[model samples]
Target: MKQFREEWDLDSIYVVDSALYSSDNFQQLRQLRWITLVTASLKVVNILVESLGEETFEDIEVPGYRIASCCSDYGGVRQRWLVVESESGRAQ
Candidate 1:
């Protein structure tokens, strides 16, 4: 990210896999200005399911896909956890 900013003078948002997830890593990332889009691991999802219940999710329709999201916090930062649930992933 430092190199990207230095070389291209651009701020970046990362779209990463669940492999990058960890409590410490999330905290570190929260300290930076970079945005992240990542899927929550099943363990994390299960915790929310158990605590909040499935009905807490609200549907959001993006251009091509549907997302179910809820108010949540990650690494002390308030954010939403989203899940895709569209078959064709198209707004039809």
Candidate 2:
């Protein structure tokens, strides 16, 4: 991400697989000020569903990331989605 920013002078967004989902990776992305759309794991989805009950989606705020959106599967396989943007991008 740093290379991308330095070389191209551009902000970036990454669509990553579930394998890359981790607290450390998230922190790194936040530090880089990059946005990411990550595939939520089943455990994560289950927890959200249990906490949210009937709600399928919500916008949330975190310390360094703006959780622009979150949604759960209402049909088909159980799945969850999250669109996380760096706090620096919030104004834009």
State the C-alpha lDDT per candidate. Answer: 0.55, 0.48
| lDDT of residue 54 for candidate 1 | 42
TM-score of 1: 0.49
Residue 74 in model 1: lDDT = 55
Kindly report which residue stretches of model 1 are placed more than 4 angstroms away from their true locations once superposed. Answer: 1-9, 33-41, 49-65, 86-92
Error of 2 at 4 (Å): 6.0
Which ranges of candidate 2 are over 4 A from the true structure?
1-9, 32-42, 55-92
Q: Give residue 23's lDDT in candidate 2 (0 to 100).
A: 61
Cα lDDT of model 2 by residue, 60-92, tens digit: 555665442455443332333554555475455
Q: TM-scores across all candidates?
A: 0.49, 0.38
After the best TM-score superposition of candidate 1, give how far the Cα of residue 18 lies from its true spot, in angstroms.
1.8
